[model samples]
Every structure is written in C-alpha cells, then in structure tokens.
Target chain A: MTELALAIENLSFAYGAKKALDDVSFDVRPGECTILLGPNGAGKSTLFSLITHLYDSRQGRIALCGFDIKKQSLKALARLGVVFQQTTLDPDLSVTQNLRYHAALHGIGRKAADNRIQEELERLNMFERRGEKVRQLNGGHRRRVEIARALLHRPSLLLLDEPTVGLDVPSRQAIVEHVHALVKEQNLAVLWATHLIDEIAADDSLVVLHRGQIKAKGKLDYVLQTTGANDAGEVFNKLTEGHKG
Target chain B: MRLLHYWRAMMGIVGRELLRFLHQRERFISALVRPLVWLFVFAAGFRAALGVAISPPYETYILYEVYITPGLIGMILLFNGMQSSLSMVYDREMGSMRMLMVCPLPRWFLLGSKLIAGTAVGVLQSYAFLGIAWAYDIQAPLMGYVWILPALVLVGMMLGALGLLLSSLIRQLENFAGVMNFVIFPLFFMSTALYPLWKIKESSEILHTLAHYNPFSQAVELIRFALYEQFNLDALIFTALSFFVFMSAAIFGYNPSKGMMVRKGGGAP
Candidate 1:
C-alpha cells in the first residue's frame, strides 16, 4: 500500500553498438534493503547511472517516490541520495565543511544542516573527528563522512554504488551494519550495489544482475528458492553462470 | 521558499570556489604572476618597438605598459577561464563534479552557477593584477577602476563559458594540454591582446580580419574602454553574444540525454 521508493520499468541502454543494460526492471520499498549483486562489468553501475539520471535511456521509465525521473527530475532527485563508488568529498575540506556543502546543495539552512550533520556523525561514531580534513582521515573515516553527507538531507531512498570497494573489513562491516540499522530504524529504502555476498543480511531483498539483465529478484529466500541455490553466493554463481569474474 | 533554495545553492557554490581559491596559494600567485610577467618584462621590451596613435580608449599618447594594461587584464581573464576548465576536467576525473551535477536543480542553473563561480575567481585575479599595475605607475582614471568591474564580469563570464564548453568536449584530462596549446595560444596571440588590430593589418589582411573578429579582441576592447570611463557598443554586443553562444553550447553539452554524458556513459571515460 505504501509508495515504492524507486521504480524502473523496461529500462534499456546501449553504448553505440554494445548494450549496457537490457530491459531491466526492479523496485525498492521503504523499510527494505535491496542488495544488487553482480560481478564486475555486469551493468550494475549503468543501472545506478540511470536511476540517478546521470544517463538517460529513451526505452525506459524511472520513477522516484511516484515522480517520473524524466518529467519531474527536480522532485524525483530531491527524494534520492547517493554515495558514488569514487570519493566525492573534497579532500581538503573538513568533514563538517563537506557535509555543510552537501546540505546547502539540498537547500537545508545552516542551523538545520549543522544539527543534521551532528546527528549523522554522532550516529556513525564520527562526531569527534568532524574538524579533521578528509585528507587527514583514514579510508574508513572518509567513507563514514561520505555516508553522513549522503544522509544529511534524509532522503526517502539511498543508492550506494560499491561504497565499500576499497575499504578494509572492519570498515566494510561497520557500514553494512549501519545501513541495515538505518533501514530498520528509519524505514528508509536502500538499493545498494555490491558484489560482496557477505554484506547481504538474511532477510534482505536480492536482485542478481548479469550481463545487463535481471536474472533473479525478490526476498533473499525467494531468490535462493527460484535459483535452487543454497546461499547468496550460490544464488549469484548460479544466476551468472559461466560469466564469473 | 523555492527562491531561497536557489539562492542558498548559488552561495554554496560560490563560497566553495572562494575557499578553494584561498587554499591554493600557488594558483593565486601564478594567476597574478602570469600577467605581471607580461606587463613587467614583455611590455617593457616591446615599448620602444610599438607606439600608440590616439585610440578611443587612449585620449593621448601612452606608454606601452599603459596601452597593454587592458590587454594584460584580458590575458588574466583568458587564462583563468582555461584554468577553470582544467579544474572542471579534473573534477570530472576525480568524481567531485558528479556530486554537483546530481543536485535537485535545473541543469542550466547548475552550469550557470559554475560559470558565475569561475567568473568570480577570474574577476578577483583581474582586480589583483590591476592593483599591481597601479602600484607600478600604470594607473587608470579613478572611476575607471569601478567601471571596469562590470566589464570584467561580462568578459570573464564569456571566457569562462567558453571554458565550460571546452570541458564538455574534452573527454580526458590528458587531452586538455592540446586545448591549452591549440586553443589558448592562438586566441591570445591572434587577438589584439598583444598587438593593435591596425598594426596587425599592416602585416597581413587575413590575420587582421581574424584578429578583428576574435571575441578575445572584443573582450579586451570592452575592458580598455571601461578603464577610461568610455563605452564600446560594438565590443559590448559581441561579448554578450559570445557569452550567450558559449553558455548555451555548454548547457547543451552537459545534458544527460544528448550530450557528452551519454557518450562517456555518465562520467569521465
């Protein structure tokens, strides 16, 4: 009965003669964490680009919180937050400064932005380091600041594109746990793209994308049952058979 | 409320540029140094070789440094424009530009804000160069300093918009060096920035025509006239038209559906 946080229908994209994404369709609901599982070069980033409106495709329709991305981009984008695979934070800026910039981009006032920055940083156990430049922080702390920036506006949906790729295990684990907690506590919708199976919680949703197509999608157990696989890794391997990287 | 959002976003972008400019002392120094070198060394050497007839911007016979001061100001705007473009390319490669592009505002507004921000920096550098020129005894009319501000903003936006257009066309950071050599040098050398259009005509009519039509020439003329509290209708129209053209092209080039974004698969190659 609740509105979907994100919806993509019949999405297709191509780079000249090569197809990047083909007829991909999926949905993410509030209070859910949807893990997009794919190997390298499996069109995961392409999908993120489309949903974020970084790339446009004529053959598809994408909606964020009931607003079409093409027709109402401002409203649609206002409901979305993203942390790209590469670090988008200004390295020379302090953590708070970076967050304030993002908050300003979203039209948050200074006072409200400060409060939100503190709340997000404190939640991530990064409040004590807000004054440090992002360049001075280790990889883990930088990612935490990025996460805080992404949540500064408190969007209805969050899209993270391989956010944990270069991070160590503990940092990776901390982000995974924090995002899961956010979903549960705030009823936020999250579509996180990553190849790491260990990041998938038992009750989370799964969408296995392979070679630009959605191979299997649903609850974790549903995907396992449909693919006849024993676990998340098995499901991924089965769905993307012969294309393993 | 909506207007407030747009105002805040512009302030944020401009403030960030100012902060970045402040932090990069080398960039500031180099921006000033480039023009200062041309004024102190290059102009001094050419003073004997070049004599100025009474031009509209020059009421009486002038020293070469005084004549070339406006051109040097143009040089500052031109180089700052290219430098801003280079940074845009770098930001694209480093992924910071994507953050700006994804903001919940119209694409034209965002690009325009960037153009405005770059122009602000360019204008700052222009004023700094003018200050140094003043101390060096090459002074303009007192009110000329104030009049030149609007002219500098217009020309800076025109040059900065051109830079934005180039950034969209350039696919990689490595390719930008070619732009500097091929684009920047030709624009600087062929324009009246260094030589008067009449002097250029004495040598080659073709080169004179090219220099006459160069937007950079119009920009320099605009600044020169403004510094003397004079108005140049021709330069005003040409520079404004050029700004519109370059800015529109840049906005189109950054469009997600049809621009370089589609060709590059949404980000730097």
Candidate 2:
C-alpha cells in the first residue's frame, strides 16, 4: 500500500535542437486518477513516450512498481498497461481475439487468459459484443474494448493518452466515469492526459503541464487555492496565459 | 515456464500475420501472380534468346522455366519481404507497433519474432508458386522438395531482414514506392536471377563482377542447388552472413538512443 505505482525523477527528452520535456517529476500512487492537463505541443505525448520507454531518457530515471525502466525494462513494462491516443485495435479481429492476443503477449496461459478476458469484458459491459469484429463497433465501444484489453494483464498502472479524443460528449463522460470507477473498484493507478477542464473533478489529483514543464501539481482544490483562481479553467488560464505570447 | 510464453508470443505473431494475409486477399493473389507472370510470359520470351549449358547442378539441357524457377522463388520472397516491411511502416504509423514493443519481451526477440513471421508468409508464398509451377509439369526431385525447405527459409530470412533494415531507414509510406524500384530491380537484374554470372561476364566485365558479389545471386544459387538436392556451402555461408549483418543493422536503426535518425513519426513507443 505504501508503494507508488509509478515514479519519475528529473526526466528529460530532446529531439535535435528542440527540448520536448525538461526536468519533469511526478508520482502516481495506487487507487487514484492523476489528470495531466496540458494543451497541444505541451509535451504530454513525449512524456508518455518516455514513461513507456518508446524513447530512452538520457538525463533521468523512471520506475514502475519499483522496476527501473532503463535497467529493468521488462519488469517495469510488465506492470504497465497503456492505451494510446489513437485506436490500436485490429479492425478485422473480434474483441475476444484482440484481448486474447494481448493476454498471450503478457505470457498469460490459455485458461487464465480466457478467464481474465471474460471478466474484463463483463466488467466493461461489452461481453455481448465479444464476438463482433472491431470494425463493427462504434468508436466509443471500440475504446471500451481497448480498456478491457488493457486490464486483461492486471497491470498496476494504467496509462490513457487522450483516450476520449474523438468520442462524442456522452461517450467522453461515460469513459471518464468508467475509468474513475476502475480506480475505486480495482485499486489501479491511472495517469489520464487531457486538455478538457471538465474531466478534472474537484477531488482529483491534477498536474498542469505548460511549455514542457509542470506548472502546478496537487489536488484540484489545492491547485486552485495556490493559483488564487476560482476553478480549474481559471487556474489553467492564469498558469498558461503567459506562455501564449 | 518462460519458454511457454516465448512459444505463445511467436505463435501469436505468426497467427496475426496469417489473419492479416487472409483479410487482404489481393496481397496473396498479387504475390502469386507476379512470379507466375515471370515464369510463363518472361521465361517463354527469353527461351529463344538465352541458351543453357550443362551446369554442375544440371545433368541435361533444361528449359528456361526450369532454369529460372529458383530465381522466381527468390523474386516471390523479395516482394513479400518488401511488402511485409511496407506493412511494418504502416503499423508503426498506425500505433500497433508500439503495442508490440511494449510487451515484456526483449526488443531483439520482438524484432526476430516479426522477421520470422514475415519469413513464414514468404515461404508459404514460395510453396504456392511452386505448386502452380507443378501444374505445368515442372517438377523437382521429390527429395529435393524436402531439402529446399531450409534453403527457402534461409533465403526468406535474408531478404526479410533486408526489408526490415530498409523499413527502419525509410520513415514515410509515400517515400517507400521509390525505394522498391531502387532495391528490387537492381537486386533482381544484376544478380544471377535472370541470367547466369557466366553470361553476364561474357557481356561485360563490370556487370560480371557485380553479379559475382551480389548476395541475391548467392541466395538464388543456394535455392537452385537445393532444388536439385545438391549442396553449395559458399552460398549458405554468404546468406547466413547477410542475415546477420542486415538483422544487426535493423536492430541498430530501431534503437531508442538514436531516435532522430530513425522513425520520423513523433512520440513513438
């Protein structure tokens, strides 16, 4: 219970002359949703890449469930479940096949994999659609299948990168609610990246990322109080308005 | 216990390739049609122009189809390799590749598994082409069929690794078509795939030297020997070396430390 699901320290990444992330540090503990709020080009994707070891961090370190990403990448990655901003499902494959394939990748046995797949699909309320191809599903339902796939491995940390990007308003609200429910139900740590102010609840942990730096980080109320703002919308404006010029 | 996971991962990759192959029916048709066209149309046209002498692997004068069958097999593998690489580029852009890399396997193992999967498809395409050729009464020794399996696999790995290396270097799908022309034509025409090195030597010394050194020629010769149940140690060694070198280059090009040099897509995982 004392262990953080994810920990990053002084992580930085550069692409040629451009610095994408600089000295960014944070921790995501179990059973909480940490909303990483940032606008476009604010390095949210870059940070996720580094965290997932898409690109190696030259100047800092990252650990997942106490496993170092650079030195112990397999162990670190084993504890992580990720859904990219873009839909990663195979359009020709049925939902159960996709989930089973993911479970195989995680080294889960056939019997255990099938059990977990059934459990996850039922939890996500998509068990009836398990036999349908991914192409047959709507965007919102597809996202739900991806969520079910991510949970098949029982990962401690679940990372969602702008998951609700192209979904409708109701779909977006429902996904946020579903993920919130997951945190309470499974004790999973989630770092959900989004620019939508409405997604950040007053009690949620919040981190405002601007210009590749963490401008503010704390509980929503604490961040609002520290910035002398009335709400998250105002606080975001106050923290990022200076960089627009 | 860990071995079970590796086996599952390998099967998963191979199963996915087969599934994709089935979905894209055009790919399978085109893969077979290209080699069959060469065997029927191109070989018939060249039969009158090119003369065959009794080579070591050949006991009697053979028809043009018999002479170039191994070369056509190599062509199928070459195209399949590039096609697999094209899909890799597409997958990288579409984000499924990131999902693959995030699995708790070593990066080399992941890449190797992908190469093996692609090679399996290439080998299958070659056998299909062989089966079609059999319908025309062109048959190898029955024992040669079994012996040719390993040679086809080796050639497949060599060509597929070459494709993987190219995919790592070439980022954009729009730019890949041009690369196919540069790579496939030069490899096919300059090698012993179309004409023997001896014939090229008779035409031009420079072309002869190039064909002598071409790894594709070595691969074609390897298959040609295996078709007759003969062994060529030199061809085997050269192909094994090419596989190692090309696979190493691919692994390096996809390395995370050298991010900017490869994978132009942003924020890849």
Candidate 3:
C-alpha cells in the first residue's frame, strides 16, 4: 500500500450555522497527484482552508504525513508547502528578496536559503529576473516565482489551490505538466485543486465535491466509467444533477 | 541559522514598508510637514500666551519649540502606527494579507517583521524631524540624541503593536479614519507634549486627571523623560503596561481560527 500523505476523516465545517463542508473525508497518497474536482460553491475553498489551518474544522481531523494538523501544526506545517489561491508577496521587493523572506519563514537559514533559491530559480528558468522587483514581472513569471517560493523548503506534501485558474492554455499546461513531473520525481504528494476538467490526469485519483459533500471519489477511470461518462466534467454534472450511486 | 532567518525576514519587511513610503513621496512630505507646521506656525502663536521654563529634563533656559521635541516624537510614532494599521486593512481588501498567511513562517514572526518595518520608518522620520529641529536651532544637547534613538524605537514598537491590534479589529478601512480622528487628536492635545501636566492641572483639575489616566500621556511622558536623559519610572510603567495591553489585544485579534479569519468566513466584498 502507498504511504498515506493526507487523511481527512469526518471533517465538518460551518460559517454561522451555514454548512460549508459537511461530513467530508478523503485521503491523498504519497507520490501521487490527487485533483480536488468541484463546481462553484462545492466547498472546495472551504476544505482547502481547513487543510491549510486557515479555519479549524468543526469536527474530525486532518493528518499531513501522519502528523495531526491541530495538535502538531508547526511541525506538520513545516513538512508541508502551499501556493495560496491569491498571490501573497510584497510587490516592492525584488524576486530574490521575496523568496529569501519566504525561506526564512520556513526556518531555512541564509546559506541554505540562498542555495535553495539558486537551485529553484534555475529550475524555474527565472534566474535572469532574480534582481527585478515583483511588480515588474509579468503575470506568468510572477506565478512561477510563487511556485518556486513554495518549493524552497522541499516539502513532502504540496497544496496548490486553483493553481491554473487565470492562466492561458500554455501557461496552465506548463504548470500542470511541471507538477506532474515534480510529484513522480520527488516522491511528493500533491493536492491539486481545480474546477477545470481537462487539467485532471487520467492516472491521478479524483475527488468530486458537490454543494459541500463528496459526491464521487476514487481512481479517475473507475469514477468516470461508473458514471458512464467519457470525462470527469460529465461525471461531475451527472453527480450534481441528482444522480446518486 | 535562526537568527539569520529573522534578520533576513526583518530586512525584507522593512525594505518593503520603506519602499511603499518612498513611492508615495507626497504622503511622507505631507506627514512631515504637518508636525513642522504645528511647531513653527501653530506653536509660534501659542508660545507668547505661555511661559516657557527649564523643565526637569532640560539643563538651562530653552525655547518652547525645544521643549516639545519629545511630544513631537510621540506624534511621529502615533501617526505611523495608525497608518500601518490602516494599511493592514487595505491589504486585506486588496487580498495581499491573504497571500502572506500561506507562507510556512510563524504568524507572529510575520506580524513582528511588519511591526519592525513600520517602526523603522517611524524612527527614520523621527531622525529627519530631529535634523529639521537642529537646522532651525531648536537644538537639545547633542548627547540628548543617544537616548532619543532607544526612545523612538520603544515608542515605535508600542505604537506598532497598537496599530497591529487595531488593524485586526477594525475590519474596514472606512471605519478607521473616524476612529483615528477621535483617537489621535485627543491623545496629542491631552498629553504632556504641548504643556506639562501641572500646567494642564493649573488650568483645570479635571483636564489634568483625564490626561494623567490617558495611556498616551504616559507614552509622551516616556519619550519626554528620555529626551531629557532622565528616565521616569511612572512613564516606564505606563509604557510597559500599554505595550502589554495593546500586544495582548493584537494577539487576541490575530488568533487564526478565532479572530479575523473566522470573522472573514463569508469572504467580504
């Protein structure tokens, strides 16, 4: 059996008595990319928020690499990396400064931070622009910098919340292919969140969230075949349109 | 390694905050000019109506302008702190604050770095104002500055913490200006900056009592005491207490699941 990278069991959350995530549960395995597939208002953001410890779940627990999120947050968080749904960087600082600051936050020292920054910048093909301020970079390069910053600490589990939402086809595809290769090469567990169907890899596991509940989940081919659909989007629509197992 | 990390984080944060002020030159010029106007123009008229004397911190005869240096320093801190808090709200509105939350760093470290950066700007402005004071011959003893640096730092930190605490509570930037209006002016007018507490007492015992209880009075007094090279124990206690209170409130306001995060569950427009 694969090592469990993330385990969320009986998780429930609310906003002022309104349910955002209800009785949600799923596991993402090590060395694999698991896509969280959902439509709008399907509790994807809310679930992402809980996994990130942005909001504590009202019930159940989230374990990252077997570390409970609530009880051992820093240690658990230390082993995890994330690119938020929105960009969170100082526009005034140079690309190098932003990455360096992020490195320090993860307890990475100057020598290691510099070393890792160099390695990642080269990997992202962004070394030439290191000295440029963030506001000066175009959207695609800026997003690349964010991705590079997230990988600075070599986290075992990487969370990308709607990573390709606003990107053009080539840019989105680049991120999609890059993450796929990174997961296999590094033995990293990735929770890739997106509403777009085409981003889902046939080999990747899939979880379908609908209106705050997991309507379908498991192997991408199996789930798609069970719904008698050619693609995940059709399966998603069928699940939302009152079709039940 | 850890120290190096903090140093880098602090440097990054301070660099960003400073750059923000640099890009907005008009605002800084206006901020600096306001206090100078209060000194040269407003105080000029008020100086004749009052008797200036050698205070506890002053060694000999001094002009009214020289006497109010500490109070003016307090103004720098107070305004900077409020501006920092106001920007915190603005960052949330612009989605920048949300971005910072995802970094693997300790939340307090992030907050602390921002405070240090804001404090740094306050100190820089204080020094510039000090330079202007010297240029105009409103000079304190040259040695008076050694104490001034630490005083500016302490006062900046206290006010930065206050701003951070206020930022988390004041969810909307629209709500800030009105509250700050009520807060800043009263604190400045009631403090020992313009006149000694005793003078306010001579004018009205009730005003003296009000000023005595004002935490801002304590902050201004702390700076005043430091500027004169005499540490006031009461000022120290008051400053320490205010720091604790504001810091505690800030801690409460920023508690991830309980405070601002939960309050923002609906995701305001």
Please name the candidate that would achieve the greatest TM-score relative to the true structure. 1
Report the error of model 2 at residue B269, Å: 5.4
DockQ for candidate 3: 0.38
- Most accurate candidate by lDDT: 1
Structure candidate 2, residue pairs in collision: none
**Index of the highest-DockQ prediction:** 1
TM-score of each: 0.99, 0.97, 0.91
Q: How close to the true structure is residue A150 of candidate 3, measured as C-alpha lDDT?
A: 83
lDDT by residue for model 2 (A69-131), tens: 999999999899999999988988888888878888888988999898888888778999999
Off by over 4 Å in 3: A242-245, B1-30, B53-55, B59-61, B103-105, B202-205, B267-269
Residues B13-131, candidate 1: write the lDDT tens digits.
88888888998999999999998999999999989999888877788989989988999899999999999999999998888888898889988998888889989999999998999
If you superpose only chain B onto the true chain B, what TM-score does each candidate give?
0.98, 0.96, 0.92
The DockQ values of the predictions, listed in order, are 0.69, 0.65, 0.38
Order the candidates by TM-score, highest first — what do you get? Answer: 1, 2, 3
User: Runs in model 2 with CA error above 4 Å?
Assistant: A242-245, B259-269
- Model 3 CAPRI rating: acceptable
Query: What residue runs in model 1 are displaced by over 4 Å at the alpha carbon?
Result: B264-269
> How many residue pairs clash in model 1?
0
